[model samples]
Target: MHGPPDARSLNRRAAIKVGVALAGGIPRLGALSTDAPLQEPARLKARPGDPTLKAFAGRQQINTDGAQALAWVPESVKRDVASPLVLFLHGALRRPEIYLEQHISMADETGTIVLAPFSTIGTWDAIRGAFGRDIGVIDASLRWVFERWRIDPRRIVISGFSDGGSYGLSVGVANGDFFTRIVAWSPGFMIPVKTIGKPPVLISHGTEDQILPIDRTSRQIVPALRAAGYTVDYREFKGPHAIQKPILEEMIRELAGRR
Candidate 1:
C-alpha cells in the first residue's frame, strides 16, 4: 500500500503542475527574432475596475521563448492631473505580483502610476545585459508604457529590492536621462560605469544583511555615485535583508512630493 505523499513531495508536484499550466498558456519568447526593435503599445486606454486606475494589464512577446507582462496602478485618484510614473523591479525570487501588492496602498495614496514588470528569467542582469530575448522585451515594455501613458518623463522613478535593487542602480544611473529618481534597497554592487548621468538616488541597506554586505554598498556603490556627481541619499537601517515599511513609506512620500 502506498503511504501518504510527504509535504515536500506534494509541494514539488504542485509546483510542477503550476509551471506546466503557465507554460501552456504563455508562449516562450526565447530564441526568437532579435533583429526587430520592440514595439510600444499605441494607446493608453483606461482599464475598468483598476482600483488605482493603474492596472498591470499589458502583455508583450519579446521573443519566441516567452512574453513578460506587467500590471500598472494608474493615477486614477486625480483624474484631472497627470502624475509621475514609478517603475518597480522585483527581487531574484521573481515575485512581481507580491511587490505590486505591497506598494499598492502607497501608489493609490500618492496618485502615482506604478509599473511592475515581470522578468522572464529568475533574475535580471544589467551588467552582462539581459539574456535571450529579455533585452528587447524589457525595452519594448518600457517604451510602450511611456508612450501609452501621458507620463511626466522628468518625474520618472525606478526602484527595486535585493537583486532588483542592484538593477535599479545599474539602469537608473546609466539611464539617468530617462529617470529622475531611484530607490535601491539591500542591493549588491552593480558593474561600475565610467560616467553616470546625475540623478537623485536613495540607497537603503540593512546592517545585518549577510546576503549582500552593507559595508560593500557604503564603501563602493555610494562613493561611486558621489564621485560621479550624482546626488545620493544613503540610509542604513537596523534590520536584515528586508524592506522596512516605515522607511519605504517615507521614501515614497518624498519622491511623490517632488513631482
Candidate 2:
C-alpha cells in the first residue's frame, strides 16, 4: 500500500497534470504579456537580522461612511525604513480583524505592511449598484495607506481568503495595474478576462472543499485564465476550506520573492 504523498511529490504531480492538460490544445497562456518588468520597489528588499519584524503591530479605523467606521491595519509602527504594502480583503462575512489575526504571522515573516479594511455593513455587496461605492472605499483606504507610509506602489500585493479571495481576484483583475502580485485562497468568484495584466497570480484551493467546488476552479477557472494568457500558479491542498499553516508559509515566500 502507498503511504501518504509528500508535499513536493503532490505538487509535482499537480503541475504535470496541469501542464499536460494545456498541451496539444489552443494556446491559452498567449493573452498575457511576459515582457513586463519584474522589478519590485526597493522597500521590498529583504533585510538581514531586522528586528522590525517584532516591532510592527497596530490598528485603526477609518470612517468611510458618516456613521459607519471601517477597521483597518493603519501605518502606526515604523519598523522598516522602506517596506512594500499588502492589502488584504476579508471574506463575505466581513470580519477584517479575524482575517488579519489569521495572516499576521505571515506578514511578519515577509516584512510586509498589511492593511485589512473591514466593511461597515456585514457584507461588501450592499446592492446591485452599491459595489462601486464599496470598492471605492477600499481603494481610497489603500491609497491612504500608500500616501501615509510612502509605500512602493509597484510592490503592492493584494490577497484574500475564501469570499475574501474571490473579492481579491475581482479587485486584482479589475485593477491589475495597481498590484504586482495577487493571491487567492479558496476563491469563490471566477470572472472572464478581456485585457490581461502583467501581475502574476497565485491561486490556492482545497480539493476537498465542499463550499466551493474544486472542479469549477481547477478545471473551469484555471482554463479560463490560461486561455486569457495569464501566468497563474495554481495549488490545491488535500483539505477543506480552511487556510493551513504550511500553505500560508508558502504564500508568504511566494509574495516575498515576487517583490
- Predictions: Cα RMSD each: 11.7, 10.7
Per-candidate clash tally: 16, 5
Off-target runs (Cα >4 Å) in candidate 2 are 1-57, 64-80, 126-130, 191-196, 257-259
- Those runs of model 1 whose alpha carbons end farther than 4 Å from true positions after fitting are 1-67, 74-80, 127-132, 194-196
Q: Which numbered prediction scores highest in lDDT against the true structure?
A: 1
How far is 46's C-alpha from truth in model 1 (Å)?
20
**Per-residue alpha-carbon lDDT of candidate 2 for residues 141-200, written as tens digits (9 for 90 to 100):** 655454445455567777877656765765576567667888887765543223336578
Look at candidate 1 and tell me the lDDT of residue 209: 60
Q: Candidate 2, after superposition: displacement of residue 99 in Å?
A: 1.2
Tens-place lDDT digits, model 1, residues 91-190 = 7656677666667677777766676776667667542353334444556556555444556656678888876787677666556666788898776656
Candidate 1: minimum summed lDDT over ten consecutive residues — where?
Answer: 1-10
TM-scores, each model vs. reference: 0.69, 0.68
